[model samples]
Target: MLLINCPFCGAREEHEFHYGGQAHITRPADPEQVDDKAWADYLYYRKNTLGLQAERWQHSFGCGQWFNALRCSQTHQFKAVYKMGDDAPEGLQ
Candidate 1:
């Protein structure tokens, strides 16, 4: 099993956490003004990178706060975990 390091609870099993998708993604303010293409991009589009990826994760069984994680998509290995407002590493973006 993959061990995910929780920002609050340290390292733990992956099942304890829930994936919250890509981080820093914000919804459009004007829904009606947004065209179908923009709507589809926001709803269905995602960056499926192979290397390190910045993703949002929730510590459901612990503090229950949303945090950002720098993880490797290919290996499912987490390199770092930080709170929502915390600054991400230089290579993340």
Candidate 2:
């Protein structure tokens, strides 16, 4: 299994955390003004990149805090891990 590093709790097994899907997704400014298609796309569309990708994760069994990580989807290797609201590391973005 993947060994994920939690920003609040330090390194832990992947089973101790929960994957929160792709990061940096912004919701529509006005939900009522959004059409059906746009809303649907926002809810389901994801990059599903092959190489390095940024993802949101939660330390469910530990601190219960959310964080972002830059990892390679193919290799399951994490390049960086940071707390929520922090920008991704330079050169990796």
Tens digits of lDDT, candidate 1, 1-93: 988888777888888899999886778999899999999998999998888889999989777878999988988888889889877887655
Pairs of residues clashing in candidate 2: none
Q: How far off is residue 78 in model 1, in Å? A: 0.8
Instruction: List runs of model 2 lying over 4 Å from the truth.
Output: none
Clash totals for all models, in order?
0, 0
Among all candidates shown, the one with the greatest TM-score? 2
TM-score for each model: 0.80, 0.89
10 Cα displacement, candidate 2 (Å): 1.1
Compare the candidates by lDDT and give the number of the best one.
2
How many clashing residue pairs, candidate 1? 0
> How do the residues 23-60 of candidate 2 rate in per-residue lDDT, one tens digit apiece?
88889999999999999989999998999999999999
Candidate 2 least-lDDT 10 residues: 1-10
